[model samples]
Target: MVSERAAQVLVASNRGPVTYAFREDGTLDARRGGGGLVSGLSAIGTDADALWVCAALGDGDREAVRRGVAEPGVRMLDIDATVHADAYNGIANSVLWFVHHMLYQTPLEPVFDAQFRRQWDAYRTYNRAFADALAAESAPGAVVMIQDYHLALAPGMLRELRPDLRIGHFSHTPWAPPEYFRMLPDDVAEELVRGMLGADRLGFLTWRWASAFMQCAGNVAEDGRIVSSAPDDPRPRIRHSPTGESAFRTTLVGVHGLGAEAGFLRRRSHELDVEERMVALRDQVGGEGDRKTIVRVDRTELSKNIVRGLLAFRTLLDERPEWRERVVHVAFAYPSRQDLPVYRDYTAEVARLSEEINAQYGTPGWTPVVLHVKDDFARSLAAYRIADVALVNPIRDGMNLVAKEIPVVSDAGCALVLSREAGAYEELGDEAIVVNPYDVTGTAAALHQALTMPDGERAERTKRLAAAATALPPQQWFLEQLHALEALGEGGEEADDLGRT
Candidate 1:
């Protein structure tokens, strides 16, 4: 066995900054990941002694791990495929995702039985693997930052192994409110909260989500193992151990609403690929810009409420016949989590509804709706550039980046019809025409309002929306969290990043 090097800073997540693809031959094709995390980590500089720990997600990843694929500062654990499925699809996506997003039917679902218990055990084992890897790789007094629900339990597990390290956990989804959170088995709920409270600090995309987490952390059903400060407190803590033997652990909490990288987005939106796709999209919507375009880009996730969005577009045509061929709806419903039955059905339903609208409203010279199932970044950018009105109505979301991205990339100003429940609403609600996600009639009316707004007003609103949306760029958002976490150890003000916005 080869020895490993210790790192002063580490990041753990379900997926890493790179992925491997198995080739027809025996070789593996490695691809680097791009996004906020990649950009943020790069900002810390190469000499920071940073490392990323993630699980092998597929056969290709497993093969690369087996061969000890040497990509600097990354360690991929080749966990069992069965365990990965149970932890990822069964619990993380199925249970935690449903709870956080409030997607359960409630009448016929969420029956945690013997099989669920088995899966829960697998989830623990999966988390233990990550915790062990992190413990082995971390230096004394190091900082370990964990990401998302997939590894919720790892923080507590790692704390037990390395009590001296400073740990932080960031949740990328809206935390379920206390009432809905109690739907979980009592012990399981307590375990999850206790696990996360092990972190020195916790971060959320919005204050609403962070508040929900603090409520659950305080109210976990147990023998008062976890108790938080007053609800009015800006930053709260979870207290553990009543007796002073092991002392108490207080977890500092803060919100860091992730924002778009304005510079990269503006540059990339004008790339050759995006330019070509924009031309293609313009021709499809209507040659020579004769028609208005209502644009929506999202994954086929149930929480996105894509079906209701399509229904509202249909309602718009039915209510106002004059706009039939005068406008087009461009929808890009990208496939997500296709292995799950619910996601597959949702994707099919989106397709079916798009077809229904086209058949009902389309004419020889015009197509009312142009639906694309596959995901292409350039195409999404192209759609963003050409949007006259961007409809973003999700049932509940962490922060719908699409809502922010459109304003930043629109060549001609785009009016936003946003959902009140989205995390982004907290930031952009003033400039957006906000509506209830479930109110199709209200949404149709709002769409008409957006479509009819004076060009000058729309252009002005887009500027304000874009400005507010990019207030904290990705690098700043990330560094804020790191600074707040680091501040905790320096005997300085905690959560210094909070309220700076």
Candidate 2:
């Protein structure tokens, strides 16, 4: 295994910093990731250098070719395809993600068995692949920041290899309550918690998730000492820093926010054929500006409650006959985890419900529900821009970025109907129309209220929605965590990296 010496900071995730694409001429290009990852790095600034290690997702990566403009100091580690599949499709995304998202059925047995053990070994190997690459690449005294559940076991695995590194692990997803987490096999549960404790610090998206981690540590550690311990110490410090941005301070308002590649998402929008499609759609369905467009976009994942959202939309149309002709619900569900039977079935159910609704209320000139089950970012952005009401109802989520992202770019100033169960609710609760995710009737009523809201009230609410999404920006979120890490300087090398604007 070839290893590089080390650096100041390290980032490890399932997907690498850049994705590779091969061209006809045998040239390659890389596209960076979206969301908080990009935002976080930009916030790291020029002075702070980070070594980012992630698995390459395609053939271009397997061939060890780079496409597009590669960023400085980003290292890509490509793992074997079988190891990737067993670790990702078998364990992390399917098992751990389902557990953390509370997407599984309590009635069905979700136990760790021989097959699970085999996958567990693969999972360990998968994590070790990244850990090995990181250990080789890291500089002594580097702050190793491992991301999400995909590499939950990487912290301990990496620590075993490089004890000198100051490690930190952040969970982007919600941490399940201990009771729910205890479903895992004894060794699996114990090892996973111990794996995370190998870090010097642990970060979570919300205080609720942080509390859950502490509770799990209390149950699994036996020693009640989960968060902190001294050098030769086996435990790490735990902290909760729910991210937020001030709407008044965004680029739109000339205030600094986590500067995203807004230019990128903006340029990508024009390629989607969304504008042309929207015009055709309006002429076909709206009939001279008659229909209100309600948009909901999500990956067809279990926690998204896509099926429930569709049911509510159908119910709303049934309850309010007048809206059957006047409201068009555009549900853009991007396919996710088709390998998982539950996700596959749920996605099919979404399609079935949409078909049922449209069949019940379709006119030769109009369709009540337009459902798109493919992943297309440009179409999503375009949908966001036109939405009169944006429905974001997650059964459970770490944070619903869509709740924040849509309002920032919504051309029509959409009213957000958010689920109280989502972590984003903590920030958007006041401005949004909150509803219980499972209560289809209540959700239906909320949709009705949102669609029928007076223009003056809707405009006021839209302003608040936009404000909440922009407040923290991705750049600020990353800085807050970095500031926290800086405060915990190696044995009193402390300096206030906090109070950064």
Candidate 3:
């Protein structure tokens, strides 16, 4: 809007739809990225006048911005690299992520020393940069959507700058319960809650997480009259105001379970690259004699519970000896957050476990476990198609899309072994063999059940899973949020369908 091209809808996040990289010849290469958000933005069409604002993450991106490089419908902020690193790595990834996922060891971890306080300041500044940019670029009453924990503070700051703009914030990660969330410094915890409360509406992936957030918000907010709905209520409401005054800060909370785009996945899996990968995976699996395959694809994040999943697979083989040569585990443990020492160690542990399993049960003709660390989308889809059982067990997740995806792309059908902690459990638990992530024995049992399920039953379950999983696709999920924001009238009353789960 500063340049007179005022955008009607704006998206603010840590990463943009476009990224810049340098080729070997030293020329800047601008390439677009794709995901639910990208596809959803595209669905808005040209008339929406959408703009994406994101941080420049690398040297190429910084150079692109400095050289006045441009991408339509996108703006990249060249924040100071050091500040970004401290805020991103120190606070967002280390502190907030750990707390939300309940990853701390409690006895020896989470020492909030002076260094942490400094990083917290940098985090505030990082969020301020985004708020300032959003304020500068937004048209009057523009709908701004801030995403994830990276910009938790931005919504409140943006409200301070431009009160007229309709603001919404969505948390893509689990919301920690009040007890675990209070581990942060009291002042910091207060700031985070107030920051999120600045938005007119807040979204979580499931009712469980949305209710958890309301509990945490009510526990804090000293001056406000915090009115919270019951825990089991699908449409929970939270309003905050001064003790004697009417409700001034009415934040409608909602849960929008984002489903995979079935049409895209079904079409994409049939492409040439995917077909080639399918041939390769099928050859590797060698299902000629009815050998079964269990597929799992995830980054080596701490909360993903990759190590436990591997151990469960090992147990499945150890307890059921007759299945040693009858099945193979196809694991895609891609590297993630390698810059963090903990993540690197976790990834190494995964490799060590895979090697141990192969050494224990693998023969030359049949590898017991085929582990791939590299990221290849086609190969993942290929694995999905060939899988007889799909494993999606995470310690905590906002929503495990893989659990919903495999059913849509499987060649015949796939029995799902899912985690109770995943948001998808609320939707797919009836058809999935659910297990607690911490119970390796139980998870192995669930795996056995999934692998041994009858073909007719597997086909029936997959059909139902696919139907429920595709009920609200990604584009509709995003558009629903926009519609909710637009439906907020000047009178400041809740819409009829504003808080539907």
- Using lDDT as the yardstick, the better of models 2 and 3 is 3
- Report the candidate with higher TM-score, 1 versus 2: 1
lDDT tens digits, residues 209-310, model 2? 766777776576454333221112232333211124221100000111232344445565556487876665566457578689889989988899988898
Q: How many residue pairs clash in each candidate?
A: 0, 16, 0
Error of 3 at 297 (Å): 0.5
Query: Per-residue lDDT for 1-501 in model 3, tens only?
Result: 354887779999999999999889988999989888898887789767889999999999999999999798899999999899999999999999999999999999999999998999999999999999998898888899999999999988998888888898999899999999999988898789889988888999998888889999888766646656676666666766534666356788888999999999999999999999978876787656478999999999999999999999999999999888899999999999999999999999999999999999888777888899999999999999988999999999989899999999998899999999999999999999999999999999998999889999999999999998988798999999999888885322455332322
For model 1, residues 20-51, the per-residue Cα lDDT tens digits are: 99788879999998988888888789888999
RMSD of each: 3.3, 7.9, 2.8
- Estimate the TM-score of every prediction: 0.96, 0.86, 0.96
Full-model lDDT, candidate 3? 0.89
Q: What is the TM-score (0 to 1) of candidate 2? A: 0.86
Candidate 2: list runs displaced more than 4 Å: 1-5, 25-29, 45-48, 65-72, 223-277, 491-501
